[model samples]
Target chain A: MKLMDKLQILADSAKYDVSCSSSGSSRSNRPGGVGNASLPGICHSWADDGRCISLLKVLFTNVCIYDCKYCVNRSSNDVRRASFTPDELCELTIQFYRRNYIEGLFLSSAVIRSPDYTMELMIKALRKLRHEYRFNGYIHIKSIPGADMRLVHEAGSLADRMSINIELPSVSGLKLLAPQKDPASILEPMGYVRERIMESRELVLYKKPQPFVPAGQSTQLIVGATRDSDLKILTLTEHLYRRYQLKRVYYSAYVPVNDDRNLPSVNTSPPLLREHRIYQADWLLRFYGFKAGELLDEGHPNLDTHLDPKCDWALRHLDQFPVEINKAPLEMLLRVPGIGYRMAAKIIRARRVGPLGFEDLKRMRVVLKRARYFITCNGRYYGGIDLDSGLLYQLLSDKTDSKVMAGQISMFG
Target chain B: MVYVTDGSFEGILTAVFEAFRNREDPEEITLGGDFQLSMTAGIREISTDTEKSDRVWRGVESKISKESLENLYMAYLSEHPRVGLYIYRYIKLGLNIGRKVEGYLQHPDVHAIYDLSRRVGSEAHLFLGILRFKKLRNGVFYACYEPDNNITQLITDHFASRLSDQAWIIHDRKRDILALFNGEEVIFTSGFPGIDHEDCEGEYEELWKRYFSAIAIESRKNPRLQRSFMPRRYWRHLPEKQL
Candidate 1:
């Protein structure tokens, strides 16, 4: 088949994975190398779906042996199958890099013939791109679930980042939809990658550091795939972060592509708002001092779809409000509804100079509309209304009209 | 009094020097050729004096932090109409308050300088991703861009470090200048007009266009969000936006 024909089929099949970040690795260009990786990733283009297309995300092939019910390229599905030769894939990447089309290659594949076979093909393409073509750009490849440990290790050394998708949030869900896959198959490789990364750090202290996934590893969890509650997902995510030390946990809203008895109805719209709320809560977990248990519990098994997680948390714990912004610590400042990391840092810096008032916060570009209810600048409250939860919820939620809410939700859907 | 400069960064600094040396508050500062005839205020044309500009820059460097120095240069690159006077006020305030002046966000001049500098900096950062190169017949990649701010010089190091093994030219069509990186060193030159270059014939461009279209999920097509990130103003040079 033609290269364009294969790219359309393979890239379309790979689009649902939705982990396209190319940041966190600063691989410099060698003396005769063609590219370098930026510390903060660059988005080459914004797709029509409003997602950043940072990497040339494509599958090595769309032919699978295992019939995962949720996947587009599952074995039973009668989709067109195609695969790229190692040389063709490397040439495509170099040509696109020369034209400034992408940061690097994000290569994934279906279980073509066997896990080991698929991984070997991916490693061959990466080796040609890195060694033969002398390309030093960011390359993110997938670690096949049941690939050989040696093949996984070799692929890790060549790629900047690697990901092993958990596919579903729970073990029972995996059993119901993808019986051929098991949790151990996924976690074993993740454990190995983490160990090697730590060993590489230690080796760096003694010798020239060899890059083994310098951008770190990340995984994706399919939201709304099964009847998994937000609590269950968060619990699993927390475990992954603490145990595996993963860089990111991307949550892709389950878009119903296959008509399976186990999956959601084909007519159901993806849970984009839920995915967004999960991202917000994820930010709180990673940046803010909030733990997963603090954000959601047995009483509230799901995030408030209308209100953001921060605002919801603030409203629930009103006793924490009315904190003096001038004297509050950085952690306290970050808990405010509208205050972000950058704004909190600014407040900390500016307050060191002198006592700041509400005007100072406004001039510093702080979003006072939501923060005023929770903060007191210089012992004075600027939130004119009384501290009523119902009133505040009405005010905050009413500001976003239905049309604007739809626009915002669909932007990251 | 109004002060007119020669439209270079040094000329603006020189105008500030002249304003401070004369101890006169200029009502306005503009580029040399942009002086409007005023009915009452006197106009002074300041030549580009490297010695005076360097002294003023040294004073700024010693008084403020290195970050503040970058802010001043970025604000000058913004090319806003009243940015000269705003930067002058910012420098005067910074000199008085020492390095703590950056935290004085309440000051109008400080706030204006910060906003202008951020605008230029963000635009330059955006082009680091948005700029696209097309292979020419001579094996030198060429790209053309028309950014709102004068950021051609600011983004050279980024591409130079990334595409270090290839020869490339980034032509700023609006400013009529080109940044040419020939594998090792980068140099600025006058922009050249259309050349007799043939487009490379390959399936890679076609493959890229296909991948670009295929990756977007059809269920969530949001052109407004796409425009917010990659605005319509920059669509002219993007290969995916082309046929």
Candidate 2:
């Protein structure tokens, strides 16, 4: 098949795995080399899906032996199958890199013949790019579930980031949908990679440094595919972060591509809002000091569709309202719904010079509409509605109007 | 005193130098051509002097931070007509209060200049991702972008370090300036028409477009969100946007 033909089929197959971040590693462009990785990743383009196109994400091939029901490349599916030769892959990547079309490559694949076989081919392409062509751009490769740990190690040394998709949120979901796959196969490689990454850092001074995925590791979860509650998902996310030290846990709104009885129907639209809310909660977990138990409990198993997780949490705890803006600490300032970590830090910095008034907050570009309710600027409560009034909830709720709500749905959904 | 400058970054710094030396407070510092006729009677024209500018630049570095110096230069690069006056006032304030000038957000003058500097820096940062380079027929990569602000110089180091092995040219078509880097050095040329040598396109463009469309999930198409990130104003030169 033609190179362009293979690119289309492979990229189409890989579109559903939506972790395209190219950040965290600063790979130097070697002398007489072609490219380098910037510390903060740059998004080359925004796809029509509204996702950032940071990498040239593609599968090495779409031909699979195991039939995972949620995947587009399931073995029973009669989709057009194609694969790129290692040489063709290298040629495509170099041309694209020099043209500034992508940061680097995100190489994934279906189980092509065997797990180790697929990994070896991926390592060959990566070696050619890094060694032969002297390409030093950011690469995020997928570790095949049952690939040899040695092969995974070889590939890890050459790439900047590596990820394994824990597609289902629960073991029950995996058993129901993909009985061929076991959770141990996925987590074992992840555990091994985590160990190696930690070991690389520990032996940094004593031994010749081995750069094993300098950008760290990430994982993805398929939201809304199974009957996983938000509490379950967020709990699992917190566990993954604490246990595996995962850099990111991307939640892909499960796009129903297959007609499996166990999965959602093909006509069902992906639960993008849920995915977005999970991301917000994930950020809170990572940046803001919010625990999963604080965000959700057994009583409230799902995030409110009308209110963001932060606002929902704030509404539930009204005694914390009217936080004194100037006197409040960074932790308290971040608890306000509209005030992000950036705004919180800015407040901390600016207030060190002079006390910030409501006017000053507005001038600093604070999202006062939402923040005013939760904060008192210089001891003046600007939020007209009483904190306990039901009207406060009405104002804070996102469903202000049908038109604007529709726009938000389209934007996030 | 109303001062007129040559409208370059150095010209603004020289105005700061002359202001300190002559001990005159500048009310409005306009560019040579931008000065209003009503203010022509007592206007003092400041020439670009590298020695004088460098002295003020070093003073800023010693008294404040290197970050503050970059901020001042970035604000000047905004090419605002009142930017010179803003810098003069900012320097007057910075000299006395030292590094605290950056934190005085309550002061309108300080806030206005810092805001402009921030916008310029952000534009420069955004162009790091948005700028596209096409391979020229002569084997050098060529790109032209119409950024909202002058940022070609700001983005030069990023592309230089990344594409060091290849020669490339970045053209700020909006400002009629070309930043040509021949793998070793960077040269800035201005007042030139925005036509370039032939681009060896077609194959790369087609392949990129195909990949772009194929990668977008049909169920998740949101053009408005796409526009919010990659604005329509920058779509004129992007290959995938053309398709």
Candidate 3:
């Protein structure tokens, strides 16, 4: 098919993948390549979900042999099918790059003939972009489950990053939804790639060859598809970080794109807000010293729909509140519901010079509304109006909404 | 007495330097009223001089980090209140702190500059993505934008290298500046004189608008969020806005 037709079809299909980030890579242009990737901020394209749009995420072909229940491109589903020749895809990317339409390409494919065939096609596309077209822009390739180990290795060398979607949190869930794929098929390639990246990092002193994935590996887990608890999902995410040294664990709120007797009805949109909360919690876990158990449990397996996970946790663990602003450690300050890493850094810097009182905290742009009730700096407390739970909720509700009010103040603060 | 510029970021930065050299406060300066009247006591126009500008740029570079330098560039792009004067005083204040103030990335002045920079940076990034090109009969390519901040200066180099094979004109209609790139070189000009408004064939624009509308999922129509990303002020120049 023509490249634009393929782009329209595959980008539409691949929009549901929801891990379209081109951040965190620092690859520069080679001698004859068309582009480069900036570290601090590169270009990204936003999906319908309003997340940062970075990658030109698209599938090579929507034609598949496997009938994954949630995918619109499954074999059983009657959908328009398109595929790109390596040259066509490379030319389209270079044109788009020249026009500033995209930063990098996030190329994935459904199983066309076999796992190895699909993997080889993807690798060939990347190699064409790299060697034939001399396009050095960031390329994120999807690692096909059950692909040959050697093909996966070649994919890493050509691409900046590779992701193999775990699809489901558990083996039973995987079997129920995507019976054609199994756990080992996905995990094995990821394990091999992870080990290679680690080995390359270690050998950097003695040897100069960097492995296939410089941005390292990332994977996606479908949220709200199975009855998996938030706790279970977070635990799996934590393990992915611990075991695989994965760079990111993306949670795609499951949107049923195909009809199946076993799958949930496609009437309801994915709980996007819930997915957003999970991401917030995920950020906290990765950057803010948060544990999985701290945010969820067996009984309360779901996050509160109204309040954010951190705020929910803060209310549940109120004793940890009213943390003395002048004395609390950086970790504890970061745990405060309103305080993020940026705010915490500000507090640390401000406190270094002198003692910070309520006024100083206010001047430093702390959300004194929510924070005042939770902090006592030098015996001054300007929060918790009436100290009644009902009143506190009302006061907190007004103050906690920093989104709209963030504009009233200098957003730089 | 001090004189304020017209709230344009460059005007503010120019005034800031004037205030510091004359040992005056920015708050006392007003754009065309009492301050200008008082300044008539014996004032001079700060002509845009290359050496003076380069020296000021050097002061900004030495006093602040590269990030802050970019921030100052963005701050200069804004049409905010006292922005020019604030930038001028900011540089002088930055110089006095020796170097410790450079780490004060959260200072209100720093934050303001940072915010402006992000807005300009975001617009530059978006123009890279959403910018649509047209083939004029003259064989010149053209794209028009109404960016939230004056970012036409920022995106020229990107377009220059990317479209080296073709001559292109990127016009920031809101700022009345055009980055014109011939096949060989690029220059920032005030305006395009020969281009006809009716030359908009409107077919490609219609197709782009249709594609935009089709791609926007109704299931996730968060206009609030969309507004947060692409503000309505820029809607006037957007092809989708014509619809």
Candidate 4:
């Protein structure tokens, strides 16, 4: 087949994997190298789904041997298959980099003939791109489950970041949808990569450090794939972060691409709002010092779709409200509905000059409408109404309703 | 009195220096080319004096933090109306209150300077991501951009550091300036007339367009969100946006 035809098929097949970030690694250009990786990632373009397209995300091939019921490129499905030679892949990366089309390359693949064989082809392409072409740009590649441990290590050394997708949240879900992939097959490679990263850190203390996934590893969880609750997903995500030292855990709302008896109906919309709630909860866990159990417990297994996770938490714990903004610590400031990390830091810095008032907060770009209810500046409260839980919830919901209506009009018009 | 400068960063600094030396708070400060005849005020044309500008810059560097110094430079690059007077007022405040003036977000002059500087900084950062290049027949990678701020000098260090092995030119068509890097060092020149070089018709460009179109999911098409991140103004230079 022609190259353009093959590219269309492969790229179409690869778009479902939504982990397109090329960040967190600062690999400098060598004396004769052609590129360097920026510390904060650059988004070269945004796809129609509002996701950043930083790297050239493509699959090495779209031919699979496993019959994963949820995947678009499952073995039983009848889709056009195409594969790129290692040379062709490397040449494409260099040419695109030269033309400033991408930050680097994000190479993934289906289980072509076998896990080991597919991984081997991916490593070959990466080796050529890194060593032969003298390209030092950011490269992120997927590690095939059940691949050899040695091959996984070699690939880790060459790429800036590596990821192993835990497609399902639980073991039973994996068995029902993708019986060929066991929990051990995925966790084993993750464990190996973690160990190598630790070893590389130790080496850096005394000797010249060898790079072993300097950007760290990340994984993806398919939400709405099974009947897994948000509690279950958060628990597993917490475990992965603690166990694997992962950089990021991406949540992809399940887009129904295949007609499977075990999956959601083909007409069902992806649980986008639920996915968004999960991401907000994830941010709180990572940055705001909230534990998974603290955010959700056995009683509350799902996030409130109408309100954000932070606001929901704040509404439930009103005793923490009316905190004096002039004297509140950083942690207390972060718990406010409209106060973000950046704004909290600014407040800390600004308070050094004198006591801050509501007017100062507005000038500092704080969302006074939402923050007014929770904070008091200099022993004075500017929130107009009484503090009743139901009334506050009603007020906030009314604001959200108007905002969503405005968004719909702007989007459609 | 109103002061008129030559529309350069140094010229603005020199005007500030003269304002402090004469101990006169000017009613307005504008570019010499853009100076309008105000029937109510006297106008003073300040020559571009490198010595006076350098002394004022040195005073600012010693009195304030390096971050504030860069913010002043970025605000000057914004070329916003009355930005010269705003910077002058900010510097005067910084000198009086020391570096703590930067965090005084409630002060109007300090706030205006920060706001203008933030716009220029954001624009330069956006161009870092959206600037696209095309390979010419002579193996020189070329790109054309029309940024809102005078950020050509600010963005060249990034490209020079990354693409050190290749020769490239970034033409700021809006400002009639070119930042050319020839595998070793970068030089800025405004003398070269714009060239219409024929781009190499490589097969990878075709593959790139195909990949870009194929990667977007049809079910969740939100062109508005895409435009919010990658604005419509940058689409002219993007290869994937064409055709």
Candidate 5:
């Protein structure tokens, strides 16, 4: 097949894997290398789907051996399949990297023939890019679920990041949708990669320290493909973070492409709002220091689609409301609905100079529309309504949610 | 009364020194080219001196903090009309109370410098990814961009090291500035004619444009959201956006 046709087929198949981050690694260019990895990462463009196009996200090939019902590339599906030669993949990455169209390459592939064989081809492509072309830029590769440990380790040393997607939330869901894929096959590599990452960190002072997965591991969970509670998904995400020390856990709303009795109908829209809510809760877990228990309980088994998770949590714990902005600790400020991490830090920094008034908060650009309900600037409540009134709930629930789409991050603070 | 400096960063620093030496608070401080002849009352032209500017720069470094000095410099790069006056007032408060002035969000002058510095800093950072290079027929990679602030110098530092092995030129069309990197050193030129490239829209660009469109999930198409992250202003130079 032509290179353009191969790229189109492979990229279309790869579009569902929504892990496009290029951060947590800072590999500098060698004396004659062509590129470098940035610490915070850079987004070359945003796709029409509103996702950041950081790396040249494409699959090495789209032919699979397993029939995962929710996946577009499941072997049973009647879709076009194409594979790139090692030279073809390397040339595409370097040329795009030279033009600053991408920070690096995100190379994933289906289980072609076998897991180990697919991984071998991927490593060959990666080696050519790194050794022959001297490409020091970021390369994030996916470990085919059941790939051998030694092969994964070999690939880890060459690539900046490695990930294994946990597509289903529950074991039963995995069995119903993808019976051939075992849960052990998914978690085993995650455990091994975590160990290798720990080893690399311990050997930071080695005279010739070889880094392994310098950007660390991340995974994607397919939301709404099966009957999984937000609480269940979030608990698993928190477990992944605490156990594996994963850099990020992306949630891709299931876009039904294949017809299956167990899968949601293809006519149904992807649950994009639920995915956005999960991401909001994900941020709360990672940065806001909130626990799964704090955000949800048996009574509220799902995130409220009307209000964000942070706002929902604040409304439930009204005893913590009206905390004095001048006296509240950093943790308390973070719990406020409209204040993000940067804004919370800014408030703490600005308040240290003198008592901050509402005017100062406005100047500091804190979104008082929601934060006002929870915080008191100078022993005065500007949120207007009484704290105990249920009216705050009606007022705080987002109405102009027309802009609230999945992967559309406003980042207002 | 106003002070006119020689329209350089060091010249602005020297004006700060003169404010301290003469013990007179000027109404405004103007860079040389920005000065108007109509306002001639009590206007003093402050000459640039490395010795005096260095003293002021070092004082800001030792007394306030290195970051504040960096912030002041980035704020100066905004080239705002009254940016010199804002920097003067910001330094006055910063020297009085040291680095704590960074957190003085209520102060108008401090907020001005903080906001401008962050704008310039973030734009320079944004240009790092927004820049697009097309391979010219002559074999040199060429890209063009138009930024609001004076950030060509800031972004070129990043490309110089990242693409050091290849020859490239980044043209800032709005300011008519060029960052020419010839496999070794990057030279900044103001106006030295132009090289021609019709942007042949080569095969690689076609592949990139195809990959760009294919990677987007069709079910979740939201053009408004795409514009928010990659704004309309930058779409002019983006290769895939052209499609």
Candidate 6:
């Protein structure tokens, strides 16, 4: 196939893997090199939904050996197959970089002939870009399941970031849908890479050789594909963070592309709202010092559709109401529904200057519409009867029109 | 009555400190030409004072965090004429509660400032990577930029260090600011020369245009998404946009 033809097919197939962030890495243009990745912010081409489209996100080949039901490029699907040579990809990336079209490459492939074969080809493509072409921009490569751990680490060293998609949340779901793939194959390489990175860091602590995987590792979980609850998904994400030291666990709301007996055949669009809520919960866990168990358990497996997880949790824990405005700690203030990290920091800073009154809270730009019910000013609560469940619900419903609700549910927004 | 200064960041910051001490009408603290033309009005030509300027600088610094101070600095570089007035208003809004300026992402006035700042900041950053230099006959490296934001001033330090040994002139064609480096010292002023834009086009430019065309995956072309990232307003200077 022509190079452009291959690009179209491969990029189309690769669009489903949506963890396309190019931020957080720091690489500058070499003496004669063409491109550089910024440290504080990445030069990303954002889609309408506000997701960054930085890399020339493409696959080496779309022809797969395994039939993962939720995947668009599964073996049985009637999609076109195209492959590119390493030189072709490198030339494309360099040319694109010169034109200010892209920052780098996000290259992945299906198991073309074997897991080792596919991985080796992927590594060759990246090595060609790095060593031969001297392209020093950001590169994110996918670790093939069941690929050799050594090969995974080799790819990890060359690329800025690496990701291994869990594909499905549960073992039984993987068994039912993609029997050829196993959780151990995915996590084993992840575990190996994790250890190698740790060892490299330990070596570098003594000012030795700078080590592997500088940008860390991330994983993706397919939401709404199986009957896995949000609670189960988050619990697994918590374990991945705590146990594997995973940098990010992206939740892609499943969009069924192939008709398969093992997968749930939903007639509606993917639960993008639920996936958004999961990201909010993920942020709370990562940055806001909340735990997975605090949000959900067996009883409330799914997040509430009407309210955000933070708001829902706040509503349920009504006994903690009217947290003193000036006296409450930063963490407690962050737990409130309307308050974000910025607002919490602002509240902390403002209170250090003087005792805060109700009017002062509004001047500080707190969302008093929601914070009023949850906060007390100088031990005086003006939120009497308004904090009642039925009345609060009515007020919230009245205030949150459909458009504002849509904006709240959107992760990109 | 208070006097409004010309719409420069230094001018606005000077007016802010002037309003801070003046016990006259506070609402008169606005941009240029807001005075009522009465004898009671005290119009002051606020020359750029680096000392009182640094004091207003300290106020912005002590009031908000470091990141916010940088953002306000960039926002003050926006192309909007009334941006000085808006920034003055924003700082007054911040004075009531020191951290109120920190939430620049949401508050309408602060968001307006932040949007301009982010545009200028990102453009300055993009120029660091994208701006190309050409060698003139006089051994001077000349580069022209038509930035949507007034980011030409931010490129001086970048070019100064990167091309330290070379004599160069970076002209912001739109804003009429020239950053001239004489291989020893750098100078900033407002003098932009006209150039025959068509005469400068050549093979490397053609090659760049070719690469841009070939890179787009035709089957997945979304012009809306493309426009969102590199807005059409910036395309006037880009070689690919000329194609």
Listed per prediction, chain B TM-scores read 0.95, 0.89, 0.77, 0.95, 0.89, 0.75
Q: Candidate 6's residue-wise lDDT over A295-403, tens digit each?
A: 9988888887667778888877888887998899988998988888877886776566567788777755578777787889899986766565567655543343222
DockQ for candidate 5, please give it: 0.78
Model 4 whole-model lDDT (C-alpha atoms): 0.85
Q: How does residue B151 of candidate 1 score in lDDT?
A: 96
Clashing pairs in 1: none
TM-score of the A chain in candidate 5? 0.98
Off by over 4 Å in 2: A400-413, B20-25, B35-42, B191-199
For residues B1-243, write the lDDT of model 6, one tens digit per residue. 455666566777777776676633344444565545656665655555667767887877887656667877888777565576567677777877676556533355676776688778878876664565544545565777788777877877755644555677887888788888986677889866656555443544554444345434333334654565567776665555675
**Per-candidate TM-score against the hidden true structure:** 0.96, 0.95, 0.84, 0.96, 0.96, 0.78
Query: Which is better, 4 or 5, measured by lDDT?
Result: 5
In candidate 2 chain B, where is summed lDDT lowest over 10 consecutive residues?
Answer: B192-201
TM, chain A, every candidate: 0.96, 0.96, 0.92, 0.96, 0.98, 0.92
Interface root mean square deviation of every model, in Å? 2.1, 2.4, 4.8, 2.7, 1.0, 7.3
Of candidate 2 chain A, the 10-residue stretch with the lowest lDDT total is: A404-413
Clashes of 5: 0
- After superposing candidate 4, which stretches have Cα over 4 Å from the reference? A398-413, B191-202
Candidate 5 lDDT over residue span A22-89, tens digit each: 88888988898899988888888889888888899889988999988888888988888899999999
How accurate locally is residue A351 in candidate 2, as Cα lDDT from 0 to 100? 86
Scored by CA lDDT, what does every candidate get?
A: 0.86, 0.86, 0.69, 0.85, 0.89, 0.72
| CAPRI docking class of candidate 6 | incorrect
**Selected candidate, larger lDDT, 1 vs 3:** 1
In model 6, what is the error at residue A39, expressed in angstroms? 3.4
* Separate DockQ for every predicted complex: 0.66, 0.62, 0.23, 0.61, 0.78, 0.17
The fnat of each candidate, in order, is: 0.73, 0.70, 0.11, 0.66, 0.79, 0.05
Error of 6 at A191 (Å): 0.9
Write model 1 residue lDDT over A1-413, tens digit each, in one string.
Answer: 88788888889999998888888899998888889998888878888888888898999999999999998899999999999898888888888888888899999999988999999999988998899999899999999999999999999999999999997998899999999997899999999999999999899998999889999999999999899999899888898899999988988889999998888988998887788788878878888988999989999999888888899888889887889988999999999998998889878887877788998888878888788988998899988878864688876663442222122221221
Q: Which lDDT tens digits does candidate 4 get at residues A27-65?
A: 999998888998777777777666677788889998999
Give candidate 5 regions above 4 Å deviation: A406-413, B35-42, B193-195, B199-201
